[model samples]
Target: MFDIVKQWKWYDWAMLLLRMVACISLILTFIELRDQFTLALWVVVLWELAAFSVPWLCLLLNHKAYWVTETVISGGISIYLTSIFPAAYLSFIVPAFLMAANSSGIAYRWTGPVTIVLIPLLIKLYAPSTNLILMMVHVALAFAFGFAFHLLMVNHRQNEIIRTQNTVLEQYLSQVERVTLLEERERLSKELHDTMGHTYTAVIMGLESLRSTAADAAAQHKLSDLLELTRTSLDEIRGYLHELDSPQEQLPLVQSLRQAAEEFGRNAGVKVGLRVLGDEYQISRQAKMTFYRCLQESLTNSVRHGHATRMDVLLQFELQQTRLEIQDNGRGTARIQEGFGLSAMKERASRLQGQVSIHSDSEEGTVVTCSLPRALKPADDVIKLMLVDNEPFVRDSLGMILESERDFEVVGRAEHGLDAVNMCEELQPHLILMDLEMPVMDGITATQSIKQRWPSIKVVILTTFEQKGKAVQAMRSGADGYLLKTMEPRELAEHIRIVIRGGTLMDPSISAKLFEGDASDFLEEKTVIAPLDTSAPESSPLRVLYDLTPREMEILQHLSKGMRYKSIAMKLYLSDGTVRNYASALYAKMGVRNREEAIEAANKAGLI
Candidate 1:
């Protein structure tokens, strides 16, 4: 597969020049033979033609047979020419030395040189006029020169390859360093948002409350000034957070960008239109933020630099990658330049294994394109779901609704809990939506059995009842989530997605039921069964407070206002399952089974 032309070096050129000189000298010797022309002379000319043609053919082909044939033919020609006119033997030197130098090993290196040297000896037997001493000197000098050139080329080629490899290695190291820095920046941003951000928010809220209660104008003025300073600091922190986290407060990427685009249009007096070309999906959190930043930067650049009156943002989703194009109908620049905005966009794309291209024309406006490669494994890409309900209509309805989703596959439908468990074993779906009440075996039992066998499979209790007791039992039996059948399709899908991502989801109504004062039986039984589960002194009334973290206390207060898990999660910038875990911990510390019991217990302990 190696091309002689491509691999040709200076040595090859030098050898070709020597070859041309030798060929010219041989042609002059042929002219000398033409002066004494005869029929035998014509046959000798033809013989020379056959001998000379094979060597050039070997050089072109570089094949083993050609090399072997050229060696034999050239050696024979060298002997014949030496017997007739010794000067013409110089023509064989080029081809003879080339064969020796081009050969692969030291064993084959002497073949052509030996052939050239022995030609004079072979000619001496036929004609004593052969000059053996001159022939040896010529052959020795040519072999030495050709072999030296070959060695030099081998060294140069190796060095070239090494230099190219070094450049690639340096680029790889730089990319690794950049990715590490990005990951570290993300870690710090999340830590700041979760811990310091929440703390600052509390301080601001407390300052507002303090200002409301200020007795004097002087104190109120001082409080107002302090509030303003804190607010500015919070804003600065949020700006940093936004730079690192991109979408900072939003969950879904496209919806957040749509809102942001609208707000930008209103503030900047630009018309912005957003369009999505395919079904929306849950991308990695980092990639989602990358897309948001790309969009935000494009819009900002359009407003500030392009003076764009109208802009269009398009996000096209495909199976392997997502493409984003942001075009602005502005007074475009003649040429695109990389400033902070474009540089940042490129960096973001690099982090996601994507590329960004900017095309600007003074006449046609500017278009910024970003392409990101996505590696979506089967588990993360789609959810295989099973539906279990006693009612045939209910099962069919849920199945159809879930199946309608592009990313959700309804694997099976079951009429009862036992049937659901049997079908689950065969299908091994990613998630199952089951009803609590069934004829043969309840949803709770089915969930318990299925979870016992295949613990990786997530089961959500989808029942009409908002009973706190059943919810607790289902959770204890390894159900990952609980939801009322009255939920909307979108909400249901979101919940399913949350579960598939290794998060838990429970209906807010169940949270409501846990906080109400109706679960006295469950509370009494928990107190009798395990009184020391609460991490507090027996005499202390507010026992739950000792077990709760500050963040947990904040979440509990939100729950006290009857906020759902999703709302609490959003308000605090936490995941739905994180809120659920905190609530579960709160429930455990209060010796309660559900939200109502926990809230009633908290109220009794004066902890709320």
Candidate 2:
């Protein structure tokens, strides 16, 4: 019995349940017809069987084709049964309503109302003794029951669609979050490497410098062993720092540090006050770096060594520099002892040509103050850069090199192409120094996306891979320049400035890759002009002129007239990047490095 019922679907079970209810009404009808007997009574019995069995069998067979047929058959038989037996109207009413509810859209819409209206009228005609109002009430109740079920089914389907959409949205957000997290971890690890590596290197150098001043042979031997031990320990510490940096973990930075401070207060059961002054963007990268290191060292010392119940962190930006002070009201020592943390902080300050001062006494708690001179802002004509690299060390080293110069600002750093695009949206950097191979999204696709979204922004493909195919692809994807990572820092910086000033650059190493066949050999065989040699004449006249398109020359003419990129783009019906690209091509043809040089060379050549 259980196995047989298990095969029944929900709709089949509904048909069975309806049949069960009909049984009770059919039995009552039979009692009412017991005394009255005639040939009509036998006809009534056959009609009753058709009304009860036809729709149920149709449902059991799982045939939608029979829905209209069953509705017609059930309605006719129900009316006939009611004619001979007035109380039997309910028996037909139940099956007729069920059939109509299960019918197709057009059939069900008309059939259900028609069935309800017909039941009352048929009862009045077949059995005049039956009260019309009483039969109509029963028909109305049955229709309402079926209509309620329809509404429930419609709502269920809508909910299913919503759930499906929500699932898709959740998956998309998860992927974005995972990618963002990984990029952030890469940035933090790189910061750790720069900070700790500098500290350790300083300590090692200080020890080495003191080795010659050892008092005796025994002391000199001990110094040698101590220097070796420090070197070995530094290597192990580097390995540990690498392990601690994982994408799944979140590290506290100055931007989202409120939450970190709150957590620290809650867990440590202490009151911590943090105050930041001035806009983070206005603070130079060098200043921000020094401040962060000082903050980390001071916070740890206060909570661990001082056992402070209350601490305050304050940062203030002045005209020439920023001052950060960390103070804690804890047990004060009579004399201040310079530990590794304090020494490291002093060393970091010195590197930036800044000052560090410490004050402590028995009555007053320790106060650590660090003053750092703000890095000079890049020139009004400077290039704002975003660096994209998978390697943390590369990002750090390149970023520092750019920040060290007065003509460049490293506005943002990303470990992957996707992060680079996202950060660019926020930072609005003028140029992006992109690496080809990265996680999550690669340079080629990201360059395309960025160009499509923000055509004004420039992209330079900087990578270690020296592939001809990639160089061409990068250019096709809207990259403004392509350079090998092997280029020296000064040379790379110069190339970036050239690109920023409406010139395109291809590292001399990869320039041969741009052409096909013997062009590579021809390029190699060509005489290399030394741009940096002072002994050579500043302007050397050559017989052959560079090949430039008419359009490129027109753009160069505009540049020589002192037109900005946007104005030139509008006049020429081109995008800003496109105008820059044309101007860059003109620069190459003129054998000049930037717009100014190109114009100067062109003036001498009488070309522009």
- Global fold similarity of model 1 (TM-score): 0.42
Give TM per candidate: 0.42, 0.32
> Model 2 over residues 96-157: C-alpha lDDT tens digits?
65654565455566666666776568668878978788777787777667666655555665
Reference-based lDDT, residue 188, model 2: 74
lDDT of 1 at 273: 97
Best by TM-score: 1
> What local lDDT score does residue 260 receive in model 2, on the 0 to 100 scale?
42
**Compared with the true structure, what per-residue lDDT tens digits does model 1 show for residues 204-314?**
667777888989999999999998998788778877776774333346768877976886676555689999878877676656767767777787777566767789988
Poorly placed runs, candidate 2 (over 4 Å)? 1-12, 19-70, 96-112, 122-131, 149-183, 190-237, 245-508, 511-608
Model 2: clashing residue pairs? none
